[model samples]
Target: MNKRKYEMTSRADAAARTADRIIDAMLARFATTPYENVRIEDVAADAGVTGQTLIRRFGSKAALMNATVARELARVAAAREEAAQASPTDTIHELIHHYERYGALILKTYSEAPLVAGLPALAARGRAFHVDWCRRAFPLDPSLSPTEKAVRTAQIIAICDATTWRILRFDGELDEAQTEQALAALLLPLLV
Candidate 1:
């Protein structure tokens, strides 16, 4: 019985690992491809699993996408927590590093949220996460009136948003250091 239990535990562990791989592959695709354009077979190939196995694991494309988004959201939440704990300059560095990694995925999902089922909620959740992150990263005094706090929050969010990063990094052709400087320039003043 002990040997049988050990074998069952090992199989379950392997299955969980395979599921994680499939979700990771789908996330990679979702980062680059439009949600509707992501193919299950391609994801399966990327995960080194058969398409049938993916279907068996996730039941449907939507389920697979949901699992992928959940995993990514958890990752971003943890990163945001760590970034908020850093010093202002370190936070900026952390924010830029995060944007460099997940900016495309965030923007792509937002661009398609209007057209895709289940995306509007995800987009809203992402926005809420950003709002909460900004509040933590740039806290205003409790003595301030609600209106003042609201205005300050908006400025911080706009200054540190991924779109602003794209404008500075891609459109303006700024290097990472310049991009970081620009973000800090816009953000630190508001915090002070």
Candidate 2:
């Protein structure tokens, strides 16, 4: 019975590892490739698994994408929590680092939300994460009215958003350091 139980545990652990590999491969593909261009066979090849294995693990392409989004959100949440413990400037640096790493994936997910089955909820969750981060990173004045605080929060979200990062990094052709500087210049003033 003990040996049987050990084998069962090992199998479960291996299965979990395989699933994680699939999700990681999907995320890696998402970073450079557009959502529409990402094929399940390619993701499976990248993960060192069969296409059928991906389907068995995630049920469908949409489900795989959804799982990837869920995993990415969980990672972002943990990183945000750790960053929240630091000084505000340090936190901004962390945010910039995250944007530099994940901005393309975030932008692709948002743009494909309507066309993709499960991406709308992912996009909404991303927005919620940004809003919560802004609220925690920039505390409202006790003297301010609720409406004023809400407006300020909205402004902060806009300034620190993925779209803003995309515009600076891609459209403006700024490097990560320059983008971070631009963001800090715009946000630090409002935060104070």
Candidate 3:
């Protein structure tokens, strides 16, 4: 009986390890490859698992991508929550870092969201996440009217959004530090 239990435990551990490997492989692929271009066979080979195993594990390529995005969102959400405790400038710096880390995957997800079933929901969650972060990172005066608060919140969202990051980093050809400085300059004025 003890031997059987031990065998079951070992099998569970192995399964968990396999799942981790698959997730890691997917995230790595997402870093350098676009969502539409990533092949399941490549992910399976990278994870050291069979393509059939990946299908069995995730059901389909779309499921795999969805799972990958969910995992990344959770990670970013946690980081943002932690950064919320810091000063506003520090939070902006952290936000820029998160964008620099996940910008490519985010852009790909946004572009392919309509085709991917779960991606639109994920994108909505991302927008809410940014809004919540703005609320926490930049507290408004209680005396301000609701409409004014809403407008200011919208501005904060635009300032910290991924599109702004892309324009700064890609179009303006600014490094992360420059991007963070630019965001800080834009955000600090709104707090008044």
Candidate 4:
């Protein structure tokens, strides 16, 4: 690359590193305190950066919170992918298992953060990701038309969210094997 382009890229990378540090600090604070009320100063202090630095990188607390939520959702997506790898016939079950393992923390973090109140957009991204996964995992669910398939894909994604997992696991206390069987049964209508 040209010198100017290289310099610009370097600067962008530096900014991203700063933002990551600030967000990491914010996440640490969030783990212990309510997200809605955390001041910028606290995040800056936790991150060992100046308050102005936080503002410079994230613009506002709301924006920073959104970034953190997006980061977490990406992690969730990766975990889902890893889980799906082990159970090729039942991607939905794998995703639900992933939720049982990790979804609650993300839900709690996002729900408690006012800045992450725009979660519908995040959900849309998640829905799209699930649709993509469905296209890959079950390309021929014969019962579904194209439109129906898309809708079903979205529903499966929502069903794998934290609430459903908690309902099945915590409320019902379904053992791991039982939960897997239940999810497989529950998914039969869509998958078969």
Q: Rank the candidates by lDDT, best first.
A: 1, 3, 2, 4
Q: State the displacement of the C-alpha of residue 119, model 2, in Å, after optimal TM-score superposition.
A: 2.0
Which consecutive 10 residues in model 4 have the weakest lDDT in total?
110-119
What lDDT is reached at residue 179 by model 3? 93
Q: Candidate 3: where are CA atoms >4 Å away?
A: 1-3
TM-score each candidate.
Answer: 0.91, 0.92, 0.92, 0.67
Model 4 per-residue lDDT tens digits across residues 142-184: 6668898777766665555566667777788987677666666
What does candidate 3's lDDT look like per residue over 1-192, in tens digits? 699999999999999899889988988987788777889999999999999999999998888878888888899899889988998888888989999988767777788778777878988887788788888888988888999999988898888889889999889999999999999988888888
lDDT by residue for model 1 over 10-121, one digit each (tens)?
9999999999999999988888788789889999999999999999999888878877777888899899899999888899999999989887787776787776557578
What total of clashing residue pairs does each candidate reach? Answer: 0, 0, 0, 0
- Candidate 2 per-residue lDDT, tens place, 1-192, comes to 699999999999999999999999998997788778899999999999999999999998889989999999899888887887787788788988998878877787888878779789888987888888888876767788889777877888898898998888889899988988888888887765
The runs of at least 3 residues in candidate 1 whose Cα sits more than 4 Å from the true structure, single-residue gaps closed, are none
Global lDDT of model 2 = 0.86
lDDT of 1: 0.87
Task: List the pairs of residues colliding in candidate 4.
Answer: none
Off by over 4 Å in 2: none
- Determine which window of 10 residues in candidate 1 has minimal summed lDDT: 110-119
In model 4, which runs have C-alpha deviations exceeding 4 angstroms? 1-12, 78-97, 109-120, 131-140, 143-158, 174-178, 188-190
Model 2 misses residue 61 by how many Å?
0.7
RMSD in angstroms, all models?
1.8, 1.7, 1.8, 4.3
